[model samples]
Target: MYLYKFNDPEKALDCFTAFISRFPESGNITLVYYLAYEAAGKAGKASQAETLKDELIRKFPDSDYAKGLQDPEYFKKVDSDLRTVDRMYAEAYELYQNVYYKEALARCEDILQQFPGSKMSSYVLFLRAMCIVNLQPADEARIALNEVLAAQPTKRIQTVVNGILASMDVGDKPVLYADAEMYDARYLKSVRNWTFDEEKHAENTEEDRENPYKVNKEEEYCVVILLPEDMKTMQVLHLQTRLTFLNAALKAEQKDEKGDYQVKKEDLWYKTTALQIEPFANYGEAAVYLNRVAVDKTLLKNFKGARYRIFAISKTNFSVLKRLKNAEQYVDFFVTNYFDDRGQGEIITGRQGAAAHLFKYEADEKHDFVLMVPYRQVNVKKMAELLHGIEPAFALEKETYDDRYEMVVVKNVGTQVQSMEYLQLVSRNKEIFDRLSGTSSYMFTITQSNLGILLENQNIEEYMKFFDDNYQRNQSGEVGVGDGDFVYAKSVAHKFVLFYPNTIDPFKLKTTFEEFNFAGLMVNNVKYDDEHDCMVVSGFRNKEEAMRYFQTAVDNRKLFRSLRNVDYRNFIISDSNFDTMCEKKEIEQYLQFFKKYYLE
Candidate 1:
């Protein structure tokens, strides 16, 4: 289960198989059977899964677990039935109030069996304790009441449950801190287990635990560059980049001969307000810095209309205002909290965050790339036939600019590497050059957003200029050649930085290391990650891909070879094992999973 939760299905199934053998009569055996079947399917053991499904049906014909195999709505129906427990609990509550303890107990047990984790679960447990307290033995009542407390009921339910537990604690010490210890255990306890500890649980809300602000206005101040929500995405980014550059300049200007900055460079950080440049020790210090930035020839003058805004706020009040995200509310908070209504000594107080230095891309949202072919050069039918020859998923699209062009797009081209592989296919086939000499262009690396710009402008050369500029920048080792010209989100996909003969020289790497990507790998990019800094190739779709890349590049040393003096175009190192990328990591104990109930 742990392995499954961590997304390693093969290991999870192995553990499940072992558990089945060791504890054949485990109480959770029925649930375990279904879970193992699920793990098998996820791990791509389709034959094994089909066998497990049959075994599950034959062994437990009447179980909901078996019914679920055919009926997709089985769990939804179970949930719908459980929803009636609210009114059922009301009837049970009436019986308990009228001193019908036996009847109430029956209803509570029925609800417990039918609806295990319902919203009114805590309330039902509380009623169960109440019914048993008067009718059953002291020990029975104590056990029942402890169960109620463990459910972590509402404050009203908690007060009654805590009172009952206090009466039963045989500890001779006067229970002065009973509420503190028992009532808030749910919040404090990190791990789930049967054993309870007094020190771990204490009654506290989430807000009380998380708040990291205190009110103090006269001591601290900060310069905030607000990124108003309405600003265009590029404008905000440009402002942030400019502000960052100005900060570096300030550090250089203030540093002593010994290379120590006088203003403490550590104070520079980007928090929620876009960028908090320098947190100052006094109000006058912030004022001086802001004034310097506003008037300085190189700092603020370059950015058009670089006027900044400031406000007076104490530390604690600032957190509330920031959370509210309302300028009017902050004004009101300043009026209500500070003594002088003029609002002079205000500061934002919350300080429980690490500095954000880099912007990143998450694969949750994808920026897809496509190839645009001018219609004057090639028609959709010809393009379609050509793309189909390369990869069947590659197809021609003719939506944006019908008169002048059609685009070549592949279904879910996994990475930039896979995109390049299409071009590689065309490059390898020399007949394509003569076959379509009319082909005006093939994009080097262009995203869907770039396609929109090309379509709207209807000027291919104008759009190609951006790529031309970027290529020159890439060759010249420019940090941000494509920044102003291209519109892309700051976030980039993640790649592993570990396990490397870390070097930044892309030139040292031999050709055709990616001769292997022709296999089922279909990676997005195989370019140098942080070319100015590291020796890692950035981007892999998942852990398995990462492992495969590692095995080829690091373990097998296929990625790097001594810089040789000959034959670069004949980049092949020979026939390769595709099992590295597409092959499933199989279960070591593959047969044991089927030992008990499955057929070969």
Candidate 2:
């Protein structure tokens, strides 16, 4: 009974078969035959199932089992259908294991079409829902799971569905909070033009002049704003007003690309005019100017709780964007116009080692020419489409760019621009160049460990791919605790813990762990022991129960290859050391298990 309840029907079937063989003439022999029949059916032994059914009916015709087996032909058909469904399910599962999601989904759909109201309906429905989850977006998958839920599935199926739901919500909300104090160093230099280098042009040959699509230059300023979702109408007005004021203040001193003098300065923003500062050349200077500008406390107060990173775009880059229709043209115009001394402006002076903590801007490196402006009109995929050889890396928060921009570092900027002869001006220091390029790279806000991987790989595509894959894996598990929050001192005693070996792929380990988590076998919490460079899983009630489950997993070979070394480490927590492993949070549901089952 325990083995069957634990989902090991094959082992339970063996036990039942042995029991019936020894007690053939016992008073409860008919019951034994019936039990064996059920066990055989569950274990997918159609021949054994039919034989047991026949034995129960022939030996004890007056018994309830015999009465239930009255319709032999109907029973045979039921057995045949059950075997067919099991074979189809196994094929579908195999497809899923190979990552052939489309094929797996097709197989599941076929089962639904062929066996609409069979006994395997609930399990089939669950399988279909899981296939949809793997095949579609989270929202679509959620809808499918809800349909399964509507069918009122078995407790096991319900638990699995609920677990999937719980996993979908992990890290869906914003975690990085921002307010007025979070402005970066480059917010004030939005109006300035990029400093063109005469020396860079002096070094350029005739080839550079003729083929102009290549550039290894940086933008002067990029201001990013991290905004909260659903900005109020007044907040939008205030932001517009601030931008208008800043531009108005710079019009008198700054020259247009045509070298036309600006219109006379108007006192449109009287508060900012009092500083008597000209258009900002440096970000630090602009920061100082903004601090001095006497804007209304009420108007400034509006941005206190709001999240926004306003990019202080350079006049040159801003002009380029305004003139260009798409990224392809944007790239073409920059390469043709600014490739030589004819259009190159003056080199920036004195600014070095300046950094923006709130946004992503480095003063010393050459900036990436590609910009993902906050405007909704700037479509990332369109740009990627126009520039075929190019690919995007990571997208910022949906609120940051209004779901319009993706931050991409060009690894290999295609030289073929609009059928023109173009040269490739690749940056030598891509990392430093990107930093100084004034593009925002902090949108993902990855962890230190992930940061290490990015630095090691240095391929933005690889980094973003790993990030996305990790995010999906994190969203498929019951225990959705942040890995960074793992505390050794806070671990509880007598709790079940899977002490893993030090050597293991962290990503693979996490994925395998999620697969093992189910209804009764819940993962209450997780902890990453950084000092030992391993994972500690503690949440189950006692050592004995935890060990029993662990042994069963080993016997069933339900572990990843990396975890197959059963002697690598202990799988259960000792009573003396369990609670002392870490402290417990009062809010965690796992603590209740300790209080309920162990405290008394």
Q: Point to the candidate with the largest lDDT.
A: 1
Task: Candidate 1: count the clashes.
Answer: 13
Q: Report how far off residue 158 is in candidate 2 (Å).
A: 18
Writing each residue's lDDT as its tens digit, candidate 1 over 383-456 gives: 55665777675444545556655665554444444444444455444444444444554544444555555566
The global Cα lDDT (0 to 1) of model 2 is 0.43
TM-score of the candidate numbered 2? 0.21
Q: How many residue pairs clash in each candidate?
A: 13, 26
Please give the RMSD to the true structure for each candidate, in Å: 31.3, 34.6
User: How much lDDT does candidate 1 score?
Assistant: 0.46
TM-scores of the candidates in the order shown: 0.21, 0.21
Show model 1 residue runs off by greater than 4 Å.
1-32, 35-51, 57-64, 70-72, 86-126, 131-600
